[model samples]
Target: MATESRHVTEYIDRPARVVYEYAAEPANLAHWAAGLGSSIRREDGRWFVDVPQGGRAEVAFVARNDLGVLDHEVHLPDGGIVYIPVRVIADGENAEVVLTVRRAAGMTDDEFDRDAAAVATDLATLKQILEASA
Candidate 1:
């Protein structure tokens, strides 16, 4: 059982209070999530992600809090599925986000690799936006 993993670390010049607000807000997910070219839809207690390259993924929200984890299941257009584990940790002047995606059918390893950088870029962009406002 090999798990696909990616990690991104950034030092934000802004305080946690400001960054966390944007990170923790469910609606604000689109702002950053879009960087990965993902469209998010929330309805019926589930968040759906429309990934053009991979396909549609739907995850039921189990729990979401200030310092907590969000679990989602990635479903392929061809009927394959895998679990995507995401965690958000608050760092004094920065925040740590870890997104782990399990590989599924119709998904290539390269796609996962690409997302690793895409996510980091998105976070860095967010960092820039928040720090600029501060």
Candidate 2:
């Protein structure tokens, strides 16, 4: 029961530590992740964002670590959960960010392609923001 997946990556011209630090912050998601809505808020020690699709989705990011893991789970309003696996790996003096987009059980080919394209665009946006700020 393996699901189809796509690995979208972006090469950021910044140190891995710097890229991870900025991206790990929940507040910074609005700057690059348009798929997650443009604003995020914290309430009762939980992070929530108004997803582009409609209702709010609770986001739970992995605990801060030195291993560059930025995985997170998005709890949909309808009770479905989506797990996103992301990472920042050191590439010489720069960094490479990879996000794995999994095709949902009932998702069509067109939907999967759109999802992957969105992830790619988000990664590119991340690259632009981090590089320009450096």
Candidate 3:
């Protein structure tokens, strides 16, 4: 297995604050995560999701917009962890959202590829949501 990182980004023609607010709210995850079956845990800053095809994962929010780091740890179904970093860069009224997913080590090729595809789909969904709201 090899450590790998994947990056996905989408540009939204909207105010950063608006995009940030929508993405930061966990309740909106299901709308933009491509049917990940997302739900936020009230106890911790955890987002639980069921993958598009199958399987489940949990993302524990590490740093949030409060610190300006949209980061989380994506816990795989089998107990492995992948670090996912996301950021929204604002330029005037437009904002770009970037999502970086990194597996430090011990992930199979198939897992990485599958996860990458899932992330890509989620990003597309995010773009749709943002544009729709704009």
Candidate 4:
């Protein structure tokens, strides 16, 4: 079975370089991605996030690059890794941030819709943060 993926995009009125710099930082995830938890902490060369439920998730973020590639994987306690692919592309004088979410196996349509909406909200928050600073 093929998995379904949704790409949620938000535009920020800033240069791609500036947006990329802000978005590529793993530490910034807490400020924008509320679904990822607000209290992400790094310890022993590993980052961890408090899951909304009753547990903490070990998160491994990809190395930051000059290009806006903020892909990360959430390491679930059940040994499953959920990959989140995010990018910022230059759009003339502005920047477009796109986050791709894949519908996990057996996820219902309602769940996927809610997940996509959450991702969109997160991206909007990101745009607001970067624009407000400029």
Q: Residue 29 in model 4: shift from native, Å?
A: 1.4
Per-residue lDDT tens digits of candidate 2, residues 9-49?
Answer: 99999999999999999999999999777689889999999
User: Candidates ranked by lDDT, best first?
Assistant: 2, 4, 3, 1
TM-score of each: 0.66, 0.98, 0.72, 0.94
lDDT of candidate 3 over 1-134, digit per residue (tens): 66567887777788777777788776677777763455544435556777444578886765445533567666778886766688878878788888876655667888877767877788777777888876
How well does model 1 score by local distance difference test? Answer: 0.63
Candidate 4, residues 19-132, lDDT tens digits: the string is: 988877767879989977767888998889887755788888779787778799998777788999989899999999999989999899999999999999999999999999
The TM-score between candidate 2 and the true structure equals 0.98
Per-residue alpha-carbon lDDT of candidate 1 for residues 1-134, written as tens digits (9 for 90 to 100): 66545555555676655666666555666677664346777878666777766766664554545554655555656676656566656676556656654444456878766766676777777777777877
Leading candidate by lDDT: 2
**Cα-based lDDT for every prediction:** 0.63, 0.94, 0.71, 0.88
Query: How many residue pairs collide in each prediction?
Result: 0, 0, 0, 0
**Among these predicted structures, which one has the highest TM-score?**
2
Q: Sorted on TM-score, highest at the top, how do the candidates line up?
A: 2, 4, 3, 1
